[model samples]
Target chain A: MNIVENFDLFAPRLINKKELLSGGHRACSGCGEVLAVRLMCKALGENTVIASATGCMEIVTSMYPTTAWEVPWIHVAFENAAAVASGVEAGLKALRRKGKIADCDIKVVGMAGDGGTMDIGMQALSGAMERGHDMLFVCFDNEAYMNTGIQRSSGTPMGASTTTAPAGKVSMGQKTWKKNMAEIMVAHNVPYVATACPSYPLDFIRKVEKAKKVKGPSYIHCFSVCPTGWRCPSDQTISLGRLAVETGIFPLYEVENGKYKLSAEMPKKLRPIKEYYKSQGRYRHLGEDEIKMIQDRVNKEYKKLLNKVQCLEAWS
Target chain B: MAKRVGMEVALAVAEAVGQCNIDMAAVYPITPQSHIGEHLSDLVADGKIDAEFVTVESEHSAISAIIGASGTGARVYTATSSQGLMLMHEILPIASAMRLPLVMGIANRAVSGPLNILNDHSDIMPQRDSGWISIFVENGQEAIDVSIQAFKIAEHKDVNLPVCVNIDGFQLTHMVEPVEFPDQELVDKFLPPRVPFASLHPSNPVTMGAFAMSDYFTEILKAKDEALKNSKKTILAVWDEWAKMFGRTYKPVETYKADGAEILLLTMGSMGETAEIAIDELRAKGMAVGLVKLRLWRPFPFAEIKEVLKKAKKVLVTDRAVSFGGPGGPVCGEIKAALYNEAERPAIYSYIIGLGGRDVTVGDFTSMIDKVNREEVNTDTYEFLGVRE
Candidate 1:
């Protein structure tokens, strides 16, 4: 199969004049979240509305009268991105019916950070999806509350040190495991749920394209690397995202109509988890035992995911 | 001609909102407020209203979704009770700041500690500073009237702020009463299609709810305050036009038999109706007492309140919520603040009553009046009218 040709079929034409997200915002150099948002906006095109939660992205992109968004965007309070998107979709539908607006296809997108998504925003996200609103909810998971000074979030991986969960004599960084948000979204039985990384633009773009075409609710869990929050060199952001997937820590996959498919094939012999862990300063304090624990957890989870994908393949 | 019909207050509110020809409604079910959502959904499902009814999971989501829809230039509505109202509190200010012109029905209920879901003023009092235009309803007619007018007042070009209609939960919301449903033609003429001030559209992109720094934050806040304060003009104008069309007059602070009265009582929401009865009873006994009902709660009718209370020798203010060791009740506190600098003022007395759905009979009002007349109340603090202790 010519996979590249298939990818091109769904790929959005990148137009300079129609750039939905403009440059010259206040995002830090090598910020992974902004990069992911740029690609996401390109995929969504001009016929889209974004409801961004209060975070680094919202704060950076929109400050007073100046805005980086070329398309219509709203930033309500934190924890209501999905709810806002739900309203946008509903409002557009009503307008179209009344002939107040042309019947142009418009996609509503809800954008939020890890803390906003897994912590404060969970209820609204779940509600919007359960109601089956025609919208896309993208969670840019940076693993911590980077906008609020790098506090530990529910999405922060276990043994990863944050300002709130500092590595000390008695403490071993974050105590709990990262909540599986993609799986939780799938449990909602939404029409489309996918995991993508900005490191691989084609995979991320393709997932967003598929999500846009889906009739009902779609969730995209985008793995956004935070160089500042993770205490890594700015230039290593993309490489860190690539390492996260290659090491079996963050796999790329899509769940369409409850059928799971692994989009990025994993190597038979996975790279050591230490390659991804040692590269970032947040995981620098981890002992040998902690690394082994994380390795065991990642390997186990990967095997379970592979089994599910294989089982679905057999059924098909 | 308008027709009188008997219906549950919540359903009447729903029907009135439907008649306004709103584009969308996002609702989350909560006690006393759920009936409005149910009726609106039914109206949409039955094809009586050409609108989208999104049954959201929580009040927080409901408010958020309506914000989005309203931002998209679609007239939207939502309803909530005490806890649910509290859940939507964070975004309430945003809706006003963004100037979305969304209409909300708040069935006033007691805030939880004892987990009470009954009628009280605690729910709407906290939202006083949220920058939305708030109005209190005394009965089903007012519930239907204020709800329909809320859309007009909020969407008015001059006052482009959110509006909340507060109806006493269970006390007024669940009560079945006679209401006048205005003709569809009249409603359509009164409220035209929403003319969005700055709506979200691909053809005309605009950023809303942008972050403000210290250089412009205070100025932005000042602008919002000025917008709310100026909204009073639009509110009164809308009420005047409504009266002209519907023949039902409403005032910011409505007075009942206050002429030449020595003692006066003030109340808000459904308690005003009970207070009116008490005033009649007091009048029969030849007591020089009358009642003042506060309909407008936010951008408080300060001048109107002062003008009415200025004539009385003694004013007794009744509040449904406590201020918790502060100066008396919230309403009484505002009244005192409003009249503090005046050259001459009535001797004020604050009475907290009807908390957590506790019944306040006419007798209780009369006795309370008697206690105040005899100088029996604690002058330093507010008296709880019906507390057992």
Candidate 2:
């Protein structure tokens, strides 16, 4: 039982938390998306329900008569995940008012892919946030519409290759810049909006824990690398994620009320963006000029985010 | 015993919703369907009905609000038509999938393109696969009667699905007819309270909606499909109980003098009355003609339609909507598919008629019948009746 000693540290300290996500899922081998979800479930523990949209996660989890979700789960349409979660939260509250349910700390969490969070499901998300439902919305950003054959979505990074935004004779790759979903969530005036990457498991886990305690709507945007869609090595998923944060391409930050704070502060001397870009095949076709363009965009956005955080800190 | 009085179909539906003692109603005013919401709202505001009248911003919000309220184990109702129904296209499936027992009145109307607000099936036809049990009422009396029965069918634990009662806009909606208002005590006894499986309460915190990963997506969908399909028996049982209590009988497919008929005219909503008159005129002329009224559209009475149309040699299915490049109108195409494999099925001639509030008379129906008899029956086609060429 040498494995017991290895498990003792993370497992014993970990309260064999009721597993919400059962094993034996149908996700592809070494699927980082599901792995990120598994870790999220571990952090969320039991006593949680998730409202998911239609995507790779949904298709692979519940097949016919069997289910991989141990907890009570519901799969609505692609765009109404937020609305459905709101209904769940509202329904639970109503039952409590009627004195039907016991006083337990149960939470409702909404999970969806980038497309569902940033584009199609935006209205429902906005509505739920505006209504101030007590729930958590977690967006697993895998860049493109991985479930629907690598189509372009708002979360797809610029200069990345997708079926709809393929690198062509004239075009470099995805023409548009990645949508600022964290800022969008903050604009709704939700209680919390934070960005995390699976590469930083402790940080990602901490964000999920913080979101559960928030009174109103709390949003968590997790960067989940897609090996199949991003054309990267399966083993390089964590490294690529780490490179993203280190290169200042995807800065980790959180917005509490109106105050912005950088979760992981980076030094003024940052690594070259080329180190992150060249590691993935999706950006392999980029020449020096294209790489320079992408690096410039990333630097500008990061600087803007830093300025917002600094200004908010000074004012508060 | 209850006194019967003349009432518009929309008012009848409103009365039925009130009598059922629904807890919440989220509605938006739309043509033909406006009266249904207005009457219910008036009832709620005036203390005639103890319910929450949520005046939503749009039809989408109306349905969304109902889903939220219903998810909280409250009996909820709403009414909309044409573009209003189209606006609720996204939330419709969500309501059904969550297994909420929501009842809605759809004043059937032609969808806009040429900007028309007339009686047609174009509105409800697009929602055929939306997983709600769709019931069509021919007149004011049936609208009142069926609406009461709809709550029973929708809220039954075995049939936790949404129900849509469709009445032709400007036809049955505006037309006044004798409707028997059942006693409120009887309605309260017959329609039980809604028992939702999940709600948003702080005490017993059970989640109503949750994310299903690839590990469990198909099972949820299959369960939803089975629940909807299995609800047919409950729908029939509820209708039977309603008929027994109120002494008004209803069937999925109601046939009018179809026995031994050579030609059968099939229609839904108020147009069934027009077809009945056409049948009477043709029968006087020694023609073996009859009329079949479709009362239930979803959980589409396939077996009943086949049984009713078994004896007919020629079936004329007149639809008040067109399906563009599709197989004639939506209903006719569905009817065709239902009877496609039947060895003794009759010939179905689909005619798109009475669209955009065009007046549909007995004469117009007779002409369509004549075309069916002449073997000039247009199959997989559309013909707009009573229109200026």
Candidate 3:
């Protein structure tokens, strides 16, 4: 479908205009993570239940009686969101089997921040995937532990300024490179795994729709920018996300089973990594050599991902 | 008519689970309790039972898988011991709060630090407040009998909470005894199909385990508390129904020969049988002592315990579990709390004993009662029984 036609056909059909994520949320104004969640909920529609971990999304939305969520939601401990959602999905299925529930399409979604996804919740997530449960696992990658005061997470980009990986004279920011979670998810050989960005709302919606159609486990790794944590202007959330994809720092792709398809392939002449980095204050302290080091690492990782995708396509 | 057969407590539990026609079992092998899962898996594989047996990686996943399977409105069962029980601790509350009638066999063993995998109540004691109904079986026969009863109690509409059937690890689980296996037809008649209050159904959809705000959180918690407390009567009713069919009686707290006794020895799990022998010797010596076996740990059996203790001048509470820094053991602390306001409450002395499968001889029980009489009940807590240097 053409861009306009695609928007006309898919946007309204998928968009859940009912704002489940209401305003007045304590989330920092223009929090990209919440926007991504808002858009995702809209795409998934109302017949859905969410299991959230103890993270920024959970803390900010569920403040006693004043909940931002309009949908039925559960906030279990940090590492057990996947496990809890597994229970919810199983409970729903059992009820269906017993004729307690009528035939209605329902979705179980798990939302976790980077730390919850790639670190603490990893085993539970792996187990859930291995079990082949019908559910969606969404990882809002803000790179650092924003809610817990910007600690380093596996999703934290190399040379990024986080509380645990602070920039100093002898060292750059985070020394470790960002973990390729989408690839890791694909390695699980699940039915679907896709990468998306909030900046590309239509693209993100498409991935959500695709994941919903998949029979078994699906993973969507959304590149969500944290304006407050990244030391960028609140309004720059969407623009930074766009810059990430355009600069080839966060390429969009989908892996269905073992097959790979690049969703948004940029031209060979991409924007400089510096353009993407310099926009945020997290990378402001990076010296010339450190910047080059980060750029080299990013280039190598991007090339590796591209090669893997290309090899898979060639074999298929 | 099914033929009666002698079976180990673990095997009897497995056979009962199969006979009950459980839909699914997620199990991880742990000492003592491992036979329950192993036997169940074999039964399922051999086509003796129609069920899904999931061999999980860890005790955490075993419980998590059972929670998932049970949530689906399928009858589910699993078994675990000491550290394994501790590992599944996180999922325990979830299972209960969701109102899933999940029945688990807990082979009671000491919790590890120095790593002992033998009999003790330390394991299941920590899980008392997690909202699961805990039933302690003193012998092999009771283990099998209570396991079947656990399903009925758990699935009862009034008592829709998970039930833990606690059998002392090697002492009960490994010991073979004469267990009357109820006919499958009789079991079917007594325990009907589980009608879950809520489940993962597409039609008539209702949210379970929804996040409650402070405005509604207290109400939900209060409801859970009320459900558990109100279930005491339902539990009694189920026991009565079970006894009528199986021809064996059960009580929340069973008083063994405690009529007008001056010294009351209170014990739980397999240690009660050992204490019974000691009680016989003490009674013969004119010590005026009797034994009270705590069959139900959760829902505490408070009123019955108070009633039984009223006739005794001194009560010796023997615990197979220790509560490190706390007064007495965990069970003793709970018993004290239950009896605190009673006007005629007897002098309660707590003794920590039989930890890590240490054999409890008749001498240990006799000496403990003698010490209780001679020493003026000086301390509310003492670990003098089987205390190692």
Candidate 4:
């Protein structure tokens, strides 16, 4: 069990109290991505500036004449949040050194959704990370582009149906496996890279705080469950995220300074992947054969991750 | 004391920008704008300038980075040319709409297809509707002077718009000439540190670049339009202040030898100086020819253009970039629209000239005048100055 599992919603001690995101946002019901953003903001605290890409979060929070952001937030375009955040960080560095602004530790954050991060925004993100900017980029991966309807993005998992890649007579929904965005960020050799889910609030918050303190670039990939797009009951959002972890569909881990550390204890006898798949209507069309195929693929990928962790451990 | 030294125009512009005490610059290298970025980077690296020079991966990121920096109330700068400018086209209007008050130096060049990296207005012409306060420089000195003035004009309280200073690629950017740089103290006295209207900070957090729906979209656009339109007053005031301090006056539409001229040849960018030579030669031959140089592009100087062209009987409008099939050229198209409502407009002929580094010499100007005079008719459309069949 995780800290989130032991903590109560009405309790006072765990998460920070500052409300960086106002409650009046226009996100759809049971939006795990918005919850993740809220949790991330809480971890960021007061001295943070966010550059958001055009996505569900941006559209929902910033509808002219009104804003749900209690923090300084900027939305420049769809794919350049990372680039913009790099600029903001550089600007702050220059300003502070020149004594133009107050000398304080302010974190620059770039926030985007799956499509913005995995597809259109890949280049800018890679550049910012490579430049070693003191910033963090958070990609709220809800599998597909939910803001403009359920269009399949690079982050969309195979066997999950979407508007663009629907389950038709000859198609098996998304054609390819979900991209390992965390591994990709690790390849950038950024100081910190983490995979988190808002369902585990403490885990996500801890990773964000760790990233906040990193002097160089950091990345956090949040698995945001979209009930509206996933066609699941609103109440199942949290449980389904848990099911994903337990079934080896999604794992909770962090790589800090090239060291792999699991955020939570790996479930001892992984649950069947069918439990996670059955919770979402997106994968309802998959037959037994397709389910077995996905199950085998998940196990193989999990083993690959375990091999990485073990190899690093053996060296230590 | 101001220092006058022979320097490449691009390097001079970079030195001028460094004098402004800018907080940040995110620029990508693309010729002939590459010199501007390279010099600026050196200035930052060697502690010649106290600014952050972010070497961005692409023009898109360059514009994006500067926008983010400017949102923090820091004066920012970047330079690009041709396809680089096109890469920045997406964020150009966004910058103006947000009113971040950054400045960009454009080494104007032809846009691609054949992919020629040479001097032309094709790069900047397409950015006409991007709501930037654009201006063209004829020489290295003008480039340096206007580059300094750009920060002043952009950071003005009433006119918080990004300014684009266009120096024609290779034609002006590569030209080595003596450019007088204003004293650092004098520059400081003339241009104050940017007083941001609403900067992003933790103490006073604000949401910028908010998405506007149909209900409020028009009003937001209207406000940006009004800002660009009203920027003219601030531009003139800044230039007036510069004249007082530096003894150089600049006009939106500057005229040369037009006191009693009936035939006028209007031009923009670096070609204006070559045409001046042609005007001198033609005047020596007892011809009544003059020049109207377009200095300001956007918030298009309609009144100033009309006021200058009203007295001329025949006008030869030279545009450096073609407008495809729409109109003659971007500048000429705007000129035509500007004079369409006038009570008695002059007979106008537009020629797409000096494209893709095709040199427009003194002879070319004389030939264009001859072409207009020999063809006794208003050119409803433009003709390529010397493009072969």
Candidate 5:
């Protein structure tokens, strides 16, 4: 609340108007991840270079002849965005100090999807954070491997049926919970870590700006709704993102220098998990018992988050 | 002044790289390459060089880091061997195709199966088609010289490709031989600051490593191929400039006593020196034998290879790595491909020898020649010399 209290979100306001991620990107309609990237780019401003991992963001934006990115962007591989960003940050720092390039501090940012961040790219992200590079890594979580088609990823929720983890007679869907990537990054002792959703545009913008200014490594795990992958209505993409956050399934919070705090707009009373799951077709097969199980888990996670906020214990 | 001193080959190679004024180096150490990395890190830590030394978690991350650094217009370097090189294999072609002018060193070692960590070409053989301009070193002096020269060749405006200088593990890397390090002043004059062809900077925005569909994939790949092929010109020019400055000459394909000889033994890496000794002994006994060393691996040096084998009646190509089921040895297969369809080509004999660091002494070289003399060795496949069975 303290971080968000100073800003007038609607006034002659703060967020840069420059669209660093230009139009003509090939992202599918009702894609919340692209919108999140667009918001992130707005906060990152012009003095930034991005290293994108291979996924929807990379493929949709960069297609050889034409690129949607207006900033200096590079797509290296599937899982090394953080590693590449580390090198870019180090390179720029060395170049500036040695007088090779103009002396200026440029923010280096890494972008990846759920599959890239939670699974294959986890090691690289951990390494970058451990090395304490001055960079920000953003994982756009769409719950599944959306770009490769709606297959199960580590970020896929339990009881959600995917192509790979489809609900069969003898088996339930994606049998495990979504990975807690934000906490994993926090465990690396990075300077900043946050969970954001594009539906809360102002809160997300503030987090991005904060991450951009972090002196050491920072990470933002963005929960972006995938209408295509989740088998939901395209028009409800924004609403679904908001519902997830409101229901405490994906709480908007930040761990700044190891101190946890809830975002100002975090609902005083959490909505039921059933309301969050009702919008998507992936969880259609869940019975009353499955819904109750998910509800209890969400409540328990929310309570745990509240406890952290109360402690305000910054790691020494 | 060009200073000469006795130094371990890996440390000498690191010393040479330190003088090149690189901005960053990402290293993940493996056997034989650990010294090169440790020394480079010490150079940065001790303030001997102003560079970012990244000790990455894995070789995959190490290569990826350099690729990122090079994209931002930084002169970058890295070193790996054996499984480390195997880990980096996926990212190697990406660096080249991105046209990042970074340099790397390969302490050539055998890829493990029986878990050997000594000298061989198995690690680098599979990476030949990765589009990196590779150079093989014969000894410590050449290792140091070529390591320095690799930067110039990679950053050349016309070339703009990643280059890897291959020094045979232990054979060259562990040897304490005298090396002459080119003066920093002269090196600065010879190899100037990198002027990136295209860089990632806020002032000039660009998207690199874009996804290409079928329509543009082949054309993009072909362009990368041509850039690598045409890079030979810049490689020659850079090596020529190095020769003039340092007074130590180098060639794409170097020969030792092959002039008017009936049998020319082809070799690579540090084995060239030992093979030369064998050639001398054979020549003393009135045997017309000589040696041709392949210095440049990629951009193949097709003409130089053909030229060296022009008049020789028999070409004994020694390979340190097997191609398995196909071609036998990768090096010999390359040589055979180079000499294919020649008008009066020499009878090329493929002898797979000294794999996994089974020491190829002068005796092994003489025995290979003796076998070639008694019978027409099979041209279709390679014969492993001194197989225990």
Candidate 6:
């Protein structure tokens, strides 16, 4: 297997020393969030600064004198990463104007987990996007509060089991569908909004690059498979991310200026959602009826997205 | 050559910040503190000041955004009061611990319950251990002076901690007074552009606010504590320099007619002015009473407070905020602790007064002094002065 032989013509040019996110950190084995972050940094290159929310990524990468981040990074608080990113962008602009910093090409990236983006940090994230600052906010969506022992988050899909929303005899796991954060960001009328997966590295890298190019606030909701919380085989992290997109559970798409386009549209017959569910213990309690309920929800949402893409294409 | 004009205190503070040529400002609308953000926004809009004025959604983001902006090496400013301060309480320590040289103007107001938006120290009192250097002003001129000095002190090489300049809400923020705005050249010479100790630049690539475990957490906290405690010298040095350049002097604990007084009164913020008037009237009655106003609260100004109170036979401390079931008012409690180890300290008396925007007039001050002189109150605990029976 020649490393350079398989490079796709359309894929981002991968650089050597691509470990902006180095190894020897505390992330669980086969952590898909770290992989997504690495691909993002590869796309953004060395001239990027990150304001990370307090989560698995932050706690794992930055532990005192030891750090995995080769690029500049700051973690202020859990719910204010977006706000802090706003400040970083404004500060860089101010510093550039003052001639304090010569290079003005530095990009500010706001990184947060699903909990940080969908619930506690929603206000700050919305404010940052609405303010139209030049930055990218990436939500590594692992579904539940993986860093805090699998408590349920708004991003947790229905029928998925979590500590807070367990599948008891009388109740389902999560009562509601996963929050449509990418759509919520699109509602802010931002310049760019996209959803990507770590299993599809090229697509994830491409979306991050596109987000970087957009002038104002851009957002990318990346699907990160948490093996620890999901109780799946550690080696199955990347496979689960792939299965999520293929099963129409987590669609890979982008909204550019209200124009929707699916980055990886599924085949004529999408893979059964049960395949994705059965791979993780979070959904082990779901019976046939529960699986059908999730499949119905997934199908309805996927059709809605497809209709949006078709409508946009017709207008164009 | 300096420009002196009568302006509203909040606007004056905005103007002084403008004069410092800050790179960005994050504003949130909170009463008494709103006008400062409004005026700063107008300044940014009118191009009177070249800065980025971000109108944030809430006080939490306001501090959070400034933390980010300051992280990138931009000189930034923000303002809030009362509940807004409470909202910002969580992030205040982050700014100090990260050692961001940001400046904030707190229009001092009472924190709500009965929900009052009036003058008091309750807003800043609860934030005592947030690791930011706290200063208070007595008038509009001092408000402008201290607000300007705050940037310098915060950005000082040795003291790269955040600073808060507390101007009494409504009493100073809403009132118009003659404030001497320093010349741009003077300010330029005085405050060189902020030089951040560790900025978030892609070229340098350093991590800030990293997670520290038990092995290093205490030492990191100790370092931050030392920086705050050592900031007193830089604060004094900055004030001394400002006096030489602007002809206005400030001290941590400034006195009023305290020379050879048998009794002394302690106060913070604008209440010092009313206390002074009371001192004059009492001195005419040959009571030999004086006033000692606390200009700087944090680092507690322990040495100066002890030195000033050591001479008086009896000292009365006024606090606008309560410790609720504690021995005394918040300010008075600190005073007691500071003087606890002193070989010779004053017979201290604590009074809780002027709360929830209640007026404390010269008459009230005199009455309190009379009560103390007559030994009518218990020395062990604090009394809520001017309370209805």
Q: What TM-scores does chain A show, candidate by candidate in order?
A: 0.95, 0.93, 0.95, 0.96, 0.96, 0.95
The candidate 1 chain A region of ten consecutive residues with least summed lDDT is: A10-19
TM-score of chain B of each: 0.99, 0.96, 0.97, 0.99, 0.98, 0.99
- Tens-place lDDT digits, model 2, residues B107-194: 9998999888888888988888899999998888888888888888898889899999998888889888888899988988898676
Candidate 6 lDDT by residue in tens digits, B1-389: 78778899999999999999899999899899999999999899898987888878899999999998888888899999999999999999988999889899999999989898888888998899999999999999998888899999999999989999999999989999987888889999998888778889977999998998999989989999999999999999999999999999999999999999989999999989899999999999999899999989997899998899887889999999998777669888888898899888889999999898899999999999999999998779889987998
**What is the alpha-carbon RMSD of candidate 2 to the true structure?**
5.6
lDDT of 3 by residue, A1-316 (tens): 5676767676666566688777887889879999999989888877777778888888888776567776777665677778767766765665465555566667888879989999988988888888887899999999988998999999999888889999988778898878889888998999999999999988898899888888889999999999989999998998999899988899888999888887854556667789998879989999888878777877887788789789998898
Pairs of colliding residues, candidate 1: none
Candidate 1 on B1-389: residue-level lDDT in tens? Answer: 78988899999999999999999998889898999999999999999999999988889988999999999999999999999999889989988888779899999999998899899999988888999999999999999999999999999899889999999999999999988999999989999888987888898989999998998988888998999989999999998999999999999999999988889999999988888889999999899999999999988999999999987888999999988878869999998888888888888999999999999988999999999889898656889886778
- What TM-score, computed on C-alpha atoms, does each candidate reach? 0.97, 0.81, 0.90, 0.98, 0.98, 0.98
Docking class of 6: high
What is candidate 3's CA lDDT for residue A134?
88
Q: Which portions of model 3 miss their true places by more than 4 Å?
A: A1-27, A45-49, A60-73, A89-108, A168-171, A265-267, B21-23, B46-52, B68-74, B94-100, B202-223, B374-381
Q: List the residue pairs that clash in candidate 6.
A: A87-B69
The RMSD (Cα, Å) of candidate 6 is 2.0
Residues A172-212 of candidate 1 have per-residue lDDT tens digits of 99999999999999999999999999998878987898999
Interface RMSD of 1: 0.7
Give the CA lDDT, 0 to 100, for residue A208 in model 6: 90
Cα miss at A163, model 2 (Å)?
A: 3.3
The local distance difference test score of each candidate is 0.91, 0.82, 0.82, 0.91, 0.90, 0.91
Write candidate 3's Cα lDDT for B1-389 as tens digits: 65667778888889988888677777888897899999998898898986666665678867766766565577888899999999988878877877879899988888988899888888887888898888888777777778888898898888889999988888888888886778888989988888877554333333444455678877877887888888889889988998888878999888877998988889988888778899898888887889998888887788888888876888888887777777868877877888889887788898888888888899989999998989745654476575558
Docking quality (DockQ) of candidate 4: 0.88
Tens digit of lDDT per residue, candidate 5, span A1-316?
5545556545227678889999899998999999999999999998999999999999999987889989999988998998999999999999999998998879999989999999999998888889999999999999999999899999999999999999889767999998898989889988899999999888899899999898989999999999999999999989999999999999999998888989887899999989988888999999999889889999998999998988776433
TM-score of 2: 0.81
RMSD, one per candidate, in order:
1.9, 5.6, 3.2, 1.6, 1.7, 2.0
